[model samples]
Target: MKTKLTRRLLCGLIAAPALLWAGVQAHAADIKERTLRFAFVQPKESHMGYGAQKFADLVAQKSGKKMQVKLYPNGTLGGDLQTVSALQGGTIDLTTMPPGLLVGLKKEFGAFDLPFLFNDFAEADAVLDGPVGKQFMERLPNGLVGLAYWDHGFRNVSNNRRPIAKAEDFEGLKLRALQAPLMIDTFKALGANAVPMAFTELYAALESRAVDGQDNPIVAFATNRFDEVQKHLSTTRHVYNPLMVMASRKAWDSLSADERKVLMDAANEARIEQRRVSREMEAKALAEIRKKGVLVTEVSPQERERMREKVKPVTDKYVKEIGEDVVSSFHAEIDKVRTAR
Candidate 1:
């Protein structure tokens, strides 16, 4: 009986290795060797690049080096609009951009551009990761596949003219705005002469004095060297930009189920690290911008409220355009997060 028990234990141990090997072989069979291109407008050191690289690394590791994601940063492939077009045309595999930019493709996306819509990162994350965000992605056009929402930080104003301490300070100041109607209207409502322009063309526009100011997250201001050209920075935090990681539907349709799963898993995993790096870099970037001699000013809570009031009409106009049901649901999600806190 002792010899029989010993023999059974030995046989079980011997079969374990074969079972593990078979499982590995099955997983490998579901994947294929493929390469994907990811392009964005930010530099390689920005949060966008950091997230892209992290996702790429994860894909390679998960696929046993059978997949590769090559990154193209610094608008080398073109600006956000052009990149989106490329993705739809199946010329590019992946890209990330503010959801506000997709207003042209889906009017509901304009809800994201409403000024003061989000009070903090926590609220924004809750909405974007919740049902509202999932529904928005599901409504995307046939050419795009929404993967995940990544961080782009809250936007603030920087100008060569003067600090934006009050809503009145925006009057007559020529500010470069994202090429989205809602964004232009938001700036216009605050009394600025909003000049719609692509981000890749913004630095030259500022240097040439074509636009007196621009608004972006502090990390963007520092990483893009905007402090070198702009003299003042204000913490308006008017808009919190959440970048959407998207893939070409054409490219997505060609992938195996295992490959798609790998991409989705990697994108979500990278999102956690990307948001952490973005928030962490913001303080350091603001300090560096100040050290570079840009006057940094914080808008008082009262003043921020006043600014929100000034943009109320613009928000109302867009809420109508974005559909009341959608807007109400969006605010409901935000309220749910606020109440939970």
Candidate 2:
């Protein structure tokens, strides 16, 4: 009788934990079935908005309808600052934004956006796909996990004034820049007197002559219709912009292991698809911008060299401020790129 009682007690102890575990999974599943909201500033027509939607769709599919993401585009949720603020405070679950805005939260992120740091998408991809991106992602906490960096392509100067073949032309022009600190400093250093503006406000600012010009990739200019108001496009390729896709830490913690795996897998898949779309559309966007009456200017190699020389000090100062180790890692990644190839 005593042996039978001991055996019965052992069985109940083992079964109790399994029953509790099953109960937790069911609870988590219920929580996961609710909506997830993502925010970005661009319109749904733009690739930035569409790419984010693609990510949402992937998450929904992979999670077997366990999650659904609702997108807030065109500043419906808020501008970049507000969106990031929400993400940090757990008021927003996800955001696809340029890394520039997050620098206040992680100053080392600024290192990724330093003027003229990357020559093109290939080099940018290599660096972002490697250690530089890895470190930047790990540097943030607020439940921020940088799943991948989407290319914003190279930024060029667009103006209603004459073509800019030299740096002197930038003097006194009211240029519109993304509220990026380095971009503000870089344009100021060039004597352009830039006004930082949100994307939603840019067209009106350009149309009313509140700002004389703005900068973005040719593809973005054409697709987003910035080329319509702006009369000139100079291939300055000033900064290599990358979109950071992040999720809220608070929301992420409540998820099960299976749910986490599904979300991450979907993000990885969306990145691969987004890269292909970016490349396929780039040349076509450039052609379309030219067709839209935007006079495109190509600075000669010597002229580009002179511009780089001018911005070199701007780059050096940021490195000093960020840290020696960060600067070293950045240079090592850049050293891997070559123009001749």
Number of the top lDDT candidate = 1
Residue 242 error for model 1, in Å? 0.4
| Cα RMSD to the true fold for all candidates | 7.0, 11.5
Screening candidate 2 with a backbone cut-off below 3 angstroms (N, C-alpha, C), the clashing residue pairs are 143-249
Error of 2 at 201 (Å): 2.0
TM-scores of the candidates in the order shown: 0.92, 0.87
- For residues 1-341, what per-residue lDDT tens digits would candidate 2 score against the true structure? 99999999999999888766654654556336768888888777666766787888877766656678898888887888888788877888888877877777767777767887776677888777897888788887566766777766778899988888877778888899878777788888888988998787888898899999998876678777887688888888878788888888877777777777766777778887887787667788878877777798997767776787787878888777777798678667767776336
Give per-residue CA lDDT, model 1, range 1-341, as digits (tens). 99999999999999788766644753666888889999999998998889999999988877767789999999999999999999999999999989899899889999888899999998899899999999988988769999999999999999999989999999999999999999999999999999999999999999999999999988889999998799999999999999999999999999988889889999999999999999999989989988899999999989999999999999989999999999898889899988987
Candidate 1 ranges beyond 4 A from true positions: 1-27
Clashing pairs in 1: none
